[model samples]
Target: MRILAITDLHGNYSKIIPLLQKSGEIDLVLIAGDLTNFGPDEKAEKLIDMFESPVLAIPGNCDPKSLLDVLERRDINLHNSSRTIGDVTFIGLGGSNPTPFNTPFELEEDEIESNLETLINEAEKTDNVSVLLTHAPPHCTLDEVPAGNVGCRSIAKFMDRMDLIVCGHIHEARGVMEFGKSIVVNPGMGSDGYGALIDINVDETPKIDVQLIKA
Candidate 1:
C-alpha cells in the first residue's frame, strides 16, 4: 500500500493541498500533527473532508481537545489509537513536551513517556508491520533544530522496535535513518512542501520504499 505522510502543517493549507494533489494514488494519508494553528478551525475540517483516501491524524501542540471534539463529530479518526489498513498498523501521537510558549496542548515528558509505554504494549501484540506517527521526533534521531535539542528521549527508546518511525517538528532532517533494521524518518515541515511518500508491500519481506517529496 502507498502511504503519504505529512506533518507540522501549522495551518498552511496551500502547501498541504498541493502536496495531496500532486500525490499519485496514495492508499492512506497520515497527518502527524499541527493540523491547525491556534485551535480547531474550518480549514482543518475541510482538509479532512477533501481527502479521498482514509486519513489518520494526531493533534499537534497548537490543536486543542476541542479539535478532537470537532473531528469526532465529523467522523474523522485521530491516532493515539491504532488502525490497520492493508497490512500496515499505524500508531500516532500528537503535541509535544512542555515548551516556553505554554501551549494549550502541551504534554510533559513523563506524561508522553507513559503514553509511549502504553503504545509499546499495544504494538507488541500486533503482528502487522508497525509505523509510528508523531509530531515530535524521538530524542535524537533527526528531529534536531538549530537549538541543538532533538526530541523526546523516552520516545526514542519506545520506538526502538518499530518497523518505521515517521515524524515532523524538526525540519532539517528531512530524510531516512536505517538504524540497525528499523527505519526512522522526519518528513520535515509542510510549508516548504517537504514530506514523505512511503510505499509498503506486506508480502514476504515486506518491501518498503520512502521518498522525500518537495512542494
Candidate 2:
C-alpha cells in the first residue's frame, strides 16, 4: 500500500495540490492535523475535497472544536475512532496535550491516553496492520522544540505496540524513525509544502518505506 501523509496544513490548502500531484497512485491520504490556523470548519472541508483518494484525518490543536463535527459529517474524522481499509486498520486521535499557548483543541495527557487506548482496541486485528494517526508526536521521538521534548508521555509508551505511527505538530521534528517493531513518521508542515510518502508490503522483510518530501 502507498500512503501520502500531510500535516500542519494550517489552512494553506494550495500547497497540497503539488504534493498530491507528486504522490502518484496513492492508495490513501492521511492528514495529521492543523488543517486550519485556528480557522473555521469550511477551511477543513475545502482541503479534504482537494484530495481524490480516501482520507482519514484528525483535528489539530489549532483547529476549532467544531471541526470535529464537520469531519464526522463527512465521514472522514478519525478522532478517537478506528477504521479499516484494505489490509490496514487506522486508529486516530486529534488535539494535543496542553500547550503553554492554550490552543482551542488542547487536551490533558490522561484524556489523550484514554482516547488512544479505546481507539487501539477497535483497530487491533490479527489480519490487518495497525497504524496510529495522531496530531501530536509521541514524547521525544519526533517531538522536539526549543523548549524541550514536551510530547505526550502516554503516547510515547505505546510506541512499541503499533505497526506504524504517523504524527506531526512539531514542525522541525519532521522525519522518520524506527522504534522497535514500529515505524514512526512525522511528515512535517504540510502547509509549507512538506509531506511524506510511505509504502508498505506485509510480505516484505522490513514492511515499511518512509520518505520525507516537499511539494
Candidate 3:
C-alpha cells in the first residue's frame, strides 16, 4: 500500500497539492492534523474533498473541536477510533496533551492515557498490521521543541505496540524513529510542503519503506 502522510497543514493547500500530484498512485492520504488554522472547517473540507484517494484524519491542537462535525459528516474522522483497509488497521487519537498556551484541542495527560488504553485494547483484536495515527508524536521521538519533549508520555509507552506510528504536531521536529519492530514518522508541516510517503509490502514477509519529502 502506498500511504501519503502529511500534517500540520495550517490551511495552505497550495503548498502540498503539487507533491501529491507528482506522487504516482497513492492508495491513502493520512493527514496527521491541523487541517485548518483554528478553522472555518469549510476550507479544510474543500481541501479534503479534492483528494481522490481515501482519507483518514485526526484533529490537531490548532483545529477547533467543531471540525469534528465536518469530518464526521464525511466519514473521515478517526479520533479515538479504528478502521481497517486492506491488511492494515489504523487506530487514531487526536489532540495533544495540554500545552502551556492552552490550544483548542488539548486533552489532559491522564485522559490521553486512558483513551490510548482503550484504543490499544481494541486494536489488539486484529491480526492486521496496526498503525497508530496520532496528532502528537510520542514523547521525545520527533517531538522535541526548544523547551523539551511535548509529546504524550502514554503515547511513548504504547507506541511499541504498533507496527507503525504516523504523527505530527511538532513541525520543527519532523523526523523518523525506529525501535522494537515499529517505525514512527512525523510528516512535518504541510503548509510548508513537508510530508512523507510510506510504502508497505504485505507479502509473505511484510516490509515497509518511508520517504520524507519537501514539495
Which is superior by lDDT, 2 or 3?
Answer: 2
Q: 1 or 3, which is superior by TM-score?
A: 3
lDDT for predicted candidate 1 compared with the true structure:
0.76
Tens digit of per-residue lDDT, candidate 3, span 74-162: 99999989899988889898989888988899998888899889988888887888899999888888988889888888898897799
Q: What would the TM-score be for candidate 1 when compared with the true structure? A: 0.91
Candidate 1 per-residue C-alpha lDDT over 98-179 given as tens digits, one digit per residue, 9 for 90 to 100: 7678876778888888887787678779777888887778777786677887587768777668888888766677778776
Candidate 2 regions off by >4 Å?
A: none
Q: What ranking emerges by lDDT with the best candidate at the front? A: 2, 3, 1
Write model 2 residue lDDT over 4-114, tens digit each, in one string: 999998988888889988888898999888999998888888998898888999999999989998899999988888888877888998999889998999999888888
lDDT score of residue 8 within candidate 2: 95
Tell me the spans in candidate 3 whose CA falls farther than 4 Å from its real position.
Answer: 204-206
